[model samples]
Each structure stands twice: as C-alpha cells, then as structure tokens.
Target: MESLRNLPLLDQLKDQSISTLVQTSLIALIGVLLLVKLVQRLRLNLPPGPLPLPIVGNWLQFKEGLNPRNLAELANKYGDVCMLQMGQRKVLVISSPEMAKEVLQTQGVEFGSRARNLVFDMTTGKGSDMVFADYGEHWRKMRRIATIPFFTNKVVQQSRRGWEEEVDLALNDIKEMPGSTTSGVMVNFRLQLMMYNIVYRMMFSRKFSGLHDPLYVKLMTLNLENNRLAQSFKYNYGDYVPSLKPFLKGYLKEVWETNQRRLSFLRDEFLNERKRQTGEKIGVDFFLEAAAKGEISETNVLYLIQNMNVAAIETTLWSSEWGIAELINNPQIQDKIRNELDRVLGKGVPVTEPDIANLPYLQAMVKEILRMHMVIPMLVPHMNLQATKLGKYDIPAGCRVLVNAWGIANNPKYWEKPEVFNPDRFLKEKIEPTGNDFRFIPFGSGRRSCPGSLIALPILGIVLGRIMQRFELLPPPGVDKVDLRSVGGQLSLVLASKPRVVLKPRQI
Candidate 1:
C-alpha cells in the first residue's frame, strides 16, 4: 500500500517536471528570436522613420491615401532620406535635391530598376513594356526601339508640319464655337482630343474625325477607366500585405477584365487594321518589324501602344492644361509671351519647332509650368537591384525608392517662394527641364529619364505660342482667376477643375 501511493506521487511529480521543461524551452526560444532581431536591427543603419506597428507596419498612417502632398508632409517631419515601412514593403522617400541627385544620377545604375506592384504587373504585362520593365537588356531593347521613331530629332522635323496643322485645326474650331469671344468656352475636351490626335497619329498614322467619333469616345473612356483603376491605392493593400491578397480577388478580376478589354480594343481596332493595310513605315511598323524578327513579342508591341496611349498622351495633356490655366490666371504673362513672339518670330507667324529654341521667355514658361506642376510628381518609383547605401543610411535591395519631384521642385530650400507661379525663376536661373540640375528635374535624369522630353518640350512651346499668337485667353466673366486647385494621382497631378476661358481674337 505504501509503494502504490509512492508510485502515484512519483508519476505526478514526473508530469509536473515535463510541463516545466516545456515552458522553459518555449521561453528560451522566444528570447533567442528577440535577441536575433535586435542584433540585426543594430547591425543595419536604417534611415529614421515613424515606428511601425506589428503586421500592418505604417499602413494605418496612410488612411487618407499615398500622394505627393502626403509624402511631402512625411518629408517635412523625417528629413530627406526617410524610410517608410508600408506593410512589408520598404519605401525610401527622397525629397531634397542632393539626395535626388545621388539616387537618380550618381547611383543611377544601382537605382535604375522599377519597383513593380500587383497592379503595375497586370497593366505592364509583367514587365513587357519599357516603362515598368526592370533595368536590363530587355528594357534596353525596348527603349532603343521606342526612341528611334517617336523621340528623335528627325521625327520632330518630319512631323512638325502635321503637328502645326493639328494646332491650326484646334484654333479654328475654338474660333468657330458660339460665344467663344463673349462667353468663355470649356476647351478641356477639345484640348484632350488634340493631344490624343497628336499621339495617335504618331503611333497609328490615324486620327479621330472629331470629339464625337465613336472610336475616339470608346478609346478615351477605356483609357480614363484604366488610369483610374491602375492609379488607385485601394487595390494596393494586397500588394503590401501578402495575407490580404485574397481580399483583392474581385478587384484584381476587375483590373484583369479592364486590361483584357483594352488589349482587345488595341488589337482589333488599331493593330489588326495596321496589319491589313500596308503603308509607308510608321511608328507601329517599327515595332511590327521588331516583332517579326523575334526582337520582341506581338504582346510587347501592344503594351508599347498602351504606354503611348496612357503615358505620352495624358501627361502632355495635363501639362498643357496647367500651362494654359496659368496664362489665363496671369494676363500680363500672356502679354509678355505675345510680345516675345512678335519680337522673335514676326508679328503673326505661328511658332515652328525650330523657333522654340529662340523664344527664351516661352521656354521659360514651359520650364516653370513643369516645375510648378509636375504631371508625374513621384517620377515612377525606382528600385535598387542590389543592396545600396543612400547617404548615411543603408538601403536594402528591393526597397521602393521614390524621388518626390514635386517636393524637391517646391522645396523652399532650393527655390525662393517655391509656391509661386513665376516663370521668371527659370529666366533667373538656366534650369532646363533636361534634369541636369537636380532641383528642377521635370523629366527625371540619368539612364531612365523621359525620352519623350525631346518631343514634348517643343510641342508644348508650339501649342502655347500658337494659341497665344491667335487669341488672348481670359478667365470666364465674373471670375478673377481660374481655379488652380489640383488633385493628386498615383503617378500624376492634374488640375481639379476644368478651366473655362474666353478667347478674344488677337489683331496682330
């Protein structure tokens, strides 16, 4: 009886000992993990940022949205080279010109690759296009092919007359509008059409008849929807957090559907028609030839067209709209432009591509507009292909690096009264939009700088010069100035309100 009771006691003691051992082991494992994490953090000199919470990281801070203005506020708090833990993704926001120079130019090769997200992957066909493709041989090939026909000086020479003709047509249409002189007309749609025609003609060798052309309307509507969907931050939670990916099933499906529709439209309407008809080699022909030779895929060609449709057309249109609005807001600036035009290119002659070089003030205005209102404020987020050091902080490979072009351009440290819409600033300093000076990189610098700048700058000058030459743009009656409020997008900043202005025919 004594031995049986002792056996039971011994069994109970054995069970308690095993439980104690298990608890002690668990505690020790947890301690080791915490120590390892602490040591790893101490080893890496990471940039300063707001403390990230568990799992979600700094996502809750961005409940409103991720835009240039919001990023600017962050810069104001955390210095120029600050880190933002956006869920699992590491984002380094560069605000100052010095840091921008380092990331964009000095370390261009290191930071040349693009940061791909779920939405961009779907839209860009998994890096089939140049804009979103990783910086490598494939991107090199696409860039070379795109530059040959669309962005070269020779293309500008060949296409200048056509561009001028389009401008004249636009001007004539505005002049014919009822009450165009007395009451202001909303010319936003007309301008949008003109921009589309310019790019479409270059890409497809075709132009829509007018704003009401069924094809034009369909294409514009699709592009608008595509931009809205692609540029939204709502569907990006899944991108930051892998666990949340299931929630994006419906959203991703919609994006897929929209992309399919867009691709089909491009193929059936434009690419297929081009295939049927043989003509003098045009922009599409260049890509087709490349595809035929196995240089790229047919799908790549379609993605290229998509890029031209969205990137080339929309950004230029936004810049032009902002430029015109500024002119309407400041009449003296208009008079100054008119005087410059008269002095430089004769009284009534329209500005030609070659003439843009001579018109200093007009070029200044273009530069100023680009500086004040950068269409692509963040300049397409860059990625480091390998681990790199940005200033004193260690930037891990695959971190999404953003050069806040808007913040840099508007930073008072670099610019005096950075908020003012003054063209004289450019005249005071020889800051071209060529991205040579880090302070005013309207088009980003280094290897990935916008190839379209060669064509875009001249186009802007000609359009603005031609319009100002023909008509005196004025704000609508009872309005002192056009509303210059802007709404930010994922990649672009656009005028919040469509500007309405009266065009008084100038008798030169």
Candidate 2:
C-alpha cells in the first residue's frame, strides 16, 4: 500500500513539470510573432530623410537652434516632404506651396487634428481650449459657442467706437510725453499696452489704465510666463522621447503647479468679475451668459477667456510692432501709405474702420507686413489620427505635421526678390490674407484658421492708420536703421529690438 501511494505522487510531479514547460514555450512563440509584426510596421515606405541614430535621432542637427529659418535650411537640403526622426516622434516638414495646400486643404480632414504635448496640455487646461483642442465634436462645440458673439459684421461695428477711443488715448499719451515730438520715444511698450487694453475692453466692457496697474501687471506677467514655458525648447524633451520623461519629472511638476495657480487666478479674479455684472450681455459676455445657462461649463469658459486674452493681444501687437519697424526702415513706404491716407481719410481726421475699404495702399502694406513677418510662423502643429499618404510616401499615425509658412512665403520660387520688403508686390497681386490663396496664408488656412481676423484686421487698420496720420515715425537720432532681428524660441515672430521712433505730430 505504501509503494502504491509513492507511485501516484511521482506521476503527479511529472505532470506538473510538463505543464510548466508547455506554457513557457507558448509565451516565447507569441513574443516572436509580435516582434515580427512590429518590424514590418516600422519598415513602411517613409519619406526621404536622414538616418536616425540609436535613440536621439536628428536632434544633434538642432544643437544650434530650431527656428523657422533653421528648419527652412533643412527643407532646402531634403525634398519638399522631408522626414526627420525626432526621437520616437516623426516630424513631416512641408516646404513647397503645393505640399502645403495638400496638407492644409486637400487632405485637410485626414490631418486636421492638433498634436497634444505636455506643455500645451497644461497651458490650455488639457486641450479644453478651442485653439489647441484636437479636431472633434468637442472642438466644434467650443468653437461654435465662442464664435457666436464675434461672427457677424455687427460685432465689428459695435466695437468701432471703443477702438477709436483707445487709439485716441494712445495718440494723446504719445503727444503728452515731454519732447517726444523731436526726441524719439520707445513705441512698442506703449502700443503693446494699448493693444492689451483694447482687447480687455472688448472682452469685459472695461479697460486697465496701464501696465503699472496691479491686475494688469499680474495678468500680463502670468500670460508671458505661460507662453515662455509653453514654447521653450528646454521643456520639449518629453515631446520627442516620452520614455525619458522621468528625467523632467521635477520640471513638469513645476509647470503643473504654475498652471494651477494661473487657472485659479483666472477663475477667481477675471471670470468672477464678469459674473458680478448684472445687465444684458454683449461681446464675450454673450458666451458667459451661455455658460450661466449650463450650455457650457464654467471651466471651459475660463479656458476660452485665457485663449482670447493671449490671442487677441499678442498677434496684433507683434504685427503692429513689425509694421512700424518696417515703415521706419523704409521711409518711402511710410510716405506712400500716408499719401493714400491723405487722399482717403485726410490728415487730422480720425481713421475709422470702414475707411479701410477706400485705402487699398494701406491694405496692401498690411498684407506685405504679414507676409514678411508671419505672426505665428509655424501656425500651430497639426497631427494625423491614422496612417495617411502624402505624395509618394506613407505617413504614420500620430505624426506631427509642421506647415512651414515662413519657408513657403520666402521661397525664391514663390516670390521674386523675397528678401526685400516691398508693398508693391501685394498691390499688383491683390492676394487676400484669408488663406484661400495657398501662396500667402498669414492667418493660416482651412477650419483651424484664426476667427479673430474679423476683429484683428479692423483694429490693425484703425490703429495703424491713426498713428501714421498723427505722427511722422522716424528712427532715433543715433539709430540709422530699425533693427529687424526676431525673438528666438517664441510662437510669434516678435521683434528683438523694440524700435524707438520720433513721433513728430503731422500737420493737417
């Protein structure tokens, strides 16, 4: 009986060993199959480009800088559709106008989505804001709600008086400066404030006195910091190789903390002020009313405000600064625009929004400025939801697409004498900035294009017109020419040197 029991136990132990070996063999077979599939997927017909290193691919090429010009240099070497391996992420750089239209227009829907990164997610409240949100139903809903107030011509008409009033205040301030008429004054700082106030008034039906005001200072400081952090290359390591994100854990924590503080201030201070008001709403208040009705959440409303606050101020301000700098550098262009203004609105009379129609030369000059100094050079990167084909090669899913607006605009093939600043190019061509003409898309094209152009254009027109009408802008005494160096590592093409100008009040 004892011998029989030992035989049974020995048989059970042999069965257990056989079962364990079979399971191990099956797992190894499945792993090999999956590895084969991954290799096949990686061997897809990608575009022509440089060979990637072990982990950090093509990143060494950008050791100097990764500005628009630098990216353009890469395009010059590679073809129109060049692929660069940026760590684990693949970047498709569209160079030619034909390729740009294909991505931004023809196959727009296939590549319409926005790429979400760590910094953008934090600044925009995790893709809650309309501008940076991925293309989807939620993006459509937010856009529809946000655009209701600013969609019609009536909106611009209603806001005209406010714009004129602000420009008048800006002009008066320039005149009040002691010896500003003879001795030039730094205009960028003042114009930047005026631009901020105009946007503020349009949003909340109120305005801040100047940058010195506590609230204005706080808001400005926060917004600038957010932009700096969001656009900084140092913070973009994880965007390429996400596996290395653990190294930036501390920095990510700080950004999250800063964003939280910003969101709190936006909700408690700015949004709360709007909520306290009791009246029939207008402007952005229209959207706020919808939020109150539970149509949209308060959190979304705050994010929308944050987007508009930065968008409305920075784009126009930087463009205006560049416009003024260009005019100061080329006095002939200034003379021509003033001549057109004199012919249409006449000197000493306040330039109105509607008056822009009669002033074609002024309009052309604005277009030229936009073409030369693009406000948002890269125009916010786009992404593909699924694998798609552009021309000969196939693009993998989730690839980041950068439309090189600066590259296309300045390409010698597209424009003759592209380096020189000449408004006549626009006068003869008559290309609208509406993105319809792929050759010149300063405001971008397609569904993701900036809707703020309706207000931005008119404000730019009236503000620039009034300034030229009232003041003869000249470079500072010692400065022979206005400096046009660009600010590095920024979303917008900001001027490096804030040009100081002698605002000699024009005689009627």
TM-score of 1: 0.92
Q: Residue by residue across 165-249, what tens digits does model 1's lDDT show?
A: 8888888998888878987898878888988888888888999999999999999889888899888878667988888999999
Across 349-427, the per-residue lDDT of candidate 2 in tens digits comes to 7779988988888888888888899878878888999999999888999988888888788888899898999989987
Best by lDDT: 1
What TM-scores do the predictions have?
A: 0.92, 0.90
Candidate 1 backbone collisions, by pair:
none
Clashes found in each candidate (C-alpha, N, C closer than 3 A): 0, 0
The number of the candidate with the highest TM-score is 1
